[model samples]
Target: MFISFEGIDGSGKSTQLSLLRDVLEAKGHSVITIREPGATLLSESIREILLSNKQTITSTAELLLFSSARTQLVEMIIEPALRDGKYILCDRYVDSTTAYQGYGRQLNMEHVELCNKIATRGVMPHVTFFIDVAYEQAQQRMQFTPGSAEPDRMERSGREFFERVREGYLAIAKSDPQRFVVIDGHRNREEIHADIVAYL
Candidate 1:
């Protein structure tokens, strides 16, 4: 089974993903966990470029860069793992492109969808768990104290951008109810994990 988790920066999707992976592994399943824009040399380089706050990248360029990274990841890692009968848990996937670029950046949806299709080569997760957290709450979680690590480029896209991205996620979930599972992210970690496991 291939599963992908989606959410804003501080929505706890990563934590939930780790928890789920642990449970699946304990049950003797062969599982592989990976994060998008990473997991391969080429993709890792692209990830650095994409996330660097110092680098000024255009919206179109950002979209293609993300697609480039995703293409490399899908061809080199995801496809092979699925063929090997392993459960793949991905931190983020193509839906992120749709939300971040198409909605957050206010890019053309048609182009964004086309890019996503090309990047993934039509491969999609069996199920996608979207941890839905309110934009305000998510921002609060992303807040950093003095001397702490600063936010990444994407995280600094501002309130309006993230709000649009959140709306985009909701729209995607509404359009694809069969594969998208929207979960409330305000609850405790254990409760969220139980809900995810039950869905699986």
Candidate 2:
């Protein structure tokens, strides 16, 4: 099973993905986890540059840079891992760009979707879990990382933009009930994990 977990920053995707992988593997299932824009070192470098505050680029530049990293990750990390018959869990997927860039940046969805297809070569998750959280709470969680000095670019997106991103997730979830599973991330870890497992 190829599963994708998505939401705005601090929606508990990481915790859930990690937990799910552990549970699935314990059941004798081989599992792989792929984070967006970063997996291998090369792709991680791209992720840093893309999320850095050092560069000044337009929204289109942002979209293209992200796509480039995704293309590399898909070819280098994901494709090979999937061919080995391992189940995959992704932190985020094309739905992120479609929501953030397409709706949040007000870019064209048709254009964005086409670009995603080319970048990922049509590889997508069979089950997408969107951790639902209120915009305010997500922003609040990102405000103070324990050891962090600053927020990453995506994390630093203002509440308004993040709200749009949240809306985008909702829209995607609504669009495909069969494939997309929206969960309330505000619950405790065990509760959320139970919900995800129940879905599977």
Candidate 3:
């Protein structure tokens, strides 16, 4: 089974993903975790470029860069793992492009979807979990404390952009009830984890 997790910048996706991986591994399932634009060496380089603010990128160009990363990840990691009957847990997949590019950047969603199909070669997740949180709440959680990592381009997109991102995720969740399960991110940590477990 392939499981994908999606959320805003500070929606506890990393934490929840960590817990989910541990739980699944404890159950003795063969599992591997892959974050898009990462997991592979070349893709990690691509990730740095994608997350930076070094250039003013067009929507089409942004979509293509992300798709290129997905293409590399799918070919080098995802396909091989799944072929060996390994359960793959991915953080941030093509839905991210749909939200960030398609809605937030006002790009053409159908074209983005087409690009994604080529990226993944038509491998869809068995289940996808979208952590639902308010844009304001996410911003508060994203505060850069002392010793904290610097904000990426997506993180610095401002509240209005995040609002559009929230809407994009909800729209995706609403469009596909069977594939996407949205969990309110305002809940306690344990509560959120439990909800994900229930959904799984």
lDDT at position 71, candidate 1: 96
Writing each residue's lDDT as its tens digit, candidate 3 over 26-49 gives 999988998876888888887888
**Clash numbers, per candidate:** 0, 0, 0
Better of 1 and 3 by TM-score: 1
lDDT of 1 by residue, 11-35 (tens): 9888999999999999999999999
Candidates ranked, most accurate by lDDT first: 1, 2, 3
| Residue 175 of model 2, lDDT score | 88
Which one wins by lDDT: 1 or 3? Answer: 1
The reply for model 3, stretches above 4 Å from the true place, is: 144-146
What are the clashing pairs of model 1? Answer: none
Q: lDDT value for candidate 3?
A: 0.85
TM-score (all chains, Cα) for each model: 0.97, 0.94, 0.94
Query: Which lDDT values do the candidates have, in the order given?
Result: 0.93, 0.85, 0.85
lDDT of 1: 0.93
Pairs that collide in candidate 2 are none
